[model samples]
Target: MKGVVIIPTYNERENIIPRSGGRRNASQYGIIDAVHKNLPQADVLIVDDASPDGTADVVKQKMKRDPKLHLIEREGKLGLGTAYIRGFGWALEHGYDYAFEMDADFSHDPADLPRFIAEIQKGADLVIGSRYMPGGGVVDWPAKRMILSHYANIYARFGTAAPIKDMTAGFKCYRTEVFKHIRMQEIETDGYGFQIEIDYRVWRAGFRVREIPIIFRDRRMGVSKLNKRIVWQALFLVPRLGLWNLWR
Candidate 1:
């Protein structure tokens, strides 16, 4: 089956392409190359939000040599959820059977792309790369941040009553069928809440959701895009979803 990995980027110019002249950690660059190397058959779709740092320009430059590398340049920073939604629409129109959500940074290893595909091939409608699972873990993250993430997942899980350990995880693979059943335009959340809502909706729609262990490392380059607004939105939205499920 055909698949495409969708990466949403904002000011990730330093991460997607190799630097011309600078003492940079090799791992901090070459994200596009790594994705192609690991999953040669799967096309890489980069949905850039017109980053001021020329992230989209770099993607366009590389697109010259690689036919499998595609890009979608948006007007501005439109948020992560919409970027994936746009990518999903494009993939479906192009006849791709599977779509993947992945980070531009090295936090979500490209090498693990195959494992997610393997699970999808084995009958999983949605495959999540889970960090809170037994064999999964986070590397080089502060203890406080790790603790917050762990507890946040617990809150989201019980609040939404979703059968997922890592509901907020962004790294995932979805069979194109899942998107067809889900009301994509009806989703209104972004960031953390967006991930949880998608997972909850898929489960509620009776799709097989599977989790696979993955080692998540903090981003090697660029600053994190997280903020208090995203966190606060998730805090409130989870219980609201719970209430909706109860009334249904």
Candidate 2:
């Protein structure tokens, strides 16, 4: 099946550079190489938010050498949800069968790309790489931060009543058909809440959702983009969406 991996980036030049050692980092070059290694049939789309560090330049350089690589450079640091939404639209316009959401930070392993494809082949509409599932976990995260994430997923799941184990999972694969059922224009939540919102929408649409175990590694090169506003948005949006779903 034809598939595309959508990686969102912002000021990730340090992470996208080519390193000497054979490390599975989150750089643009490393990620493209890994995706090709595991799923050569799939294409990659880098949605860069006009990274001042010249991250888009690095992707453009690679595009010269690889025809399968695609890019969309936005004006500024638009929200993460908007980046993926734009990527999904591009994938549909280009006639892709499946669209995958991934991070450029290497936090979501590119090696797992095939696993998502395998699930897609099994009639799954949405396949989530879940850290909360059995045999799934995180690496090198602080206790306080981990607790926050763990409870956040729990809270979101409870509020939304979604069957997904990882309601806030960003690493996911969605069949193009699922997108046809979802209102992409209505997805306004950004950051972690964006993940939850999509998951809930998929379930509400009656799409088959599946979660596979994956080890989520922390970013090695650049700083995290998480902020207080993102956190607060998630905290309030979950219950609001839950109530909205109920009323509808």
Candidate 3:
């Protein structure tokens, strides 16, 4: 089945390009290269939000060389949720059978991509790269951050009652058909909440959901996009969605 990997980026030029001798040095092969190495048949789509660091320029350069590389440059910094929303629409218009959500940085390992495709081929509609599952964990995070992340997932799980371990995970794949069933226009939250809402809707819609083990690493380069606003949105939105689901 044909698939597209959608990466939403803001100020991720360093991670998209190969650089020398720095803590922020991207992967030796760069994210696009690593993805191509793992899934040569899959196409890569970059949904850049007009980063000041010339991130889109690097993508354009790569696009010139590789026809499989595609880009959607937003006028400004739109939220990650909208970027993926736009990407999902584009994938549907272009006739891709499956779509993937991945980070621009190396936080989500490209090597695990094959496993996701494997699960999808086996008839799973949504495959999550879970960090809370057995054999899956985080690397290079502070104790406080890790604790918060862990409990946040628990809280989200309790709130949404999704049958998966990692509700806030950004690393996942979806059958393009799932989006056709979900009410795309009604999704309001962005950031972490976006992941939860989509997963909850997919499960509620009776799609088969599966989780695979993945060791998530913090970004090796560029600034983190996470903020207090995004976290707070998730905190409040989960219970609301859960309560709303009870009536349905």
Q: Residue-wise lDDT of candidate 2 within 193-237, one digit each (tens)?
A: 899998998999899999999999888677888899988989999
Q: Tell me the spans in candidate 1 whose CA falls farther than 4 Å from its real position.
A: 21-29
Worst 10 residues of 3 by lDDT: 18-27
The positional error of residue 155 in candidate 1, measured at the CA in angstroms, is 0.2
Screening candidate 2 with a backbone cut-off below 3 angstroms (N, C-alpha, C), the clashing residue pairs are 15-27, 16-27, 16-28
- Per-candidate RMSD, Å: 1.6, 2.1, 2.0
lDDT (0-100) at residue 193 of candidate 2? 88
- Could you tell me every candidate's TM-score relative to the true structure? 0.96, 0.95, 0.96
Sliding window of 10 residues with minimal summed lDDT for model 1: 20-29
lDDT of 3 by residue, 80-108 (tens): 99999999999999999999999998999
Report the Cα lDDT for candidate 2: 0.89
Q: Output the lDDT of residue 244, model 2.
A: 81
Query: Can you tell me which runs of candidate 2 are displaced by over 4 Å?
Result: 20-29
Q: Cα RMSD for candidate 3? A: 2.0
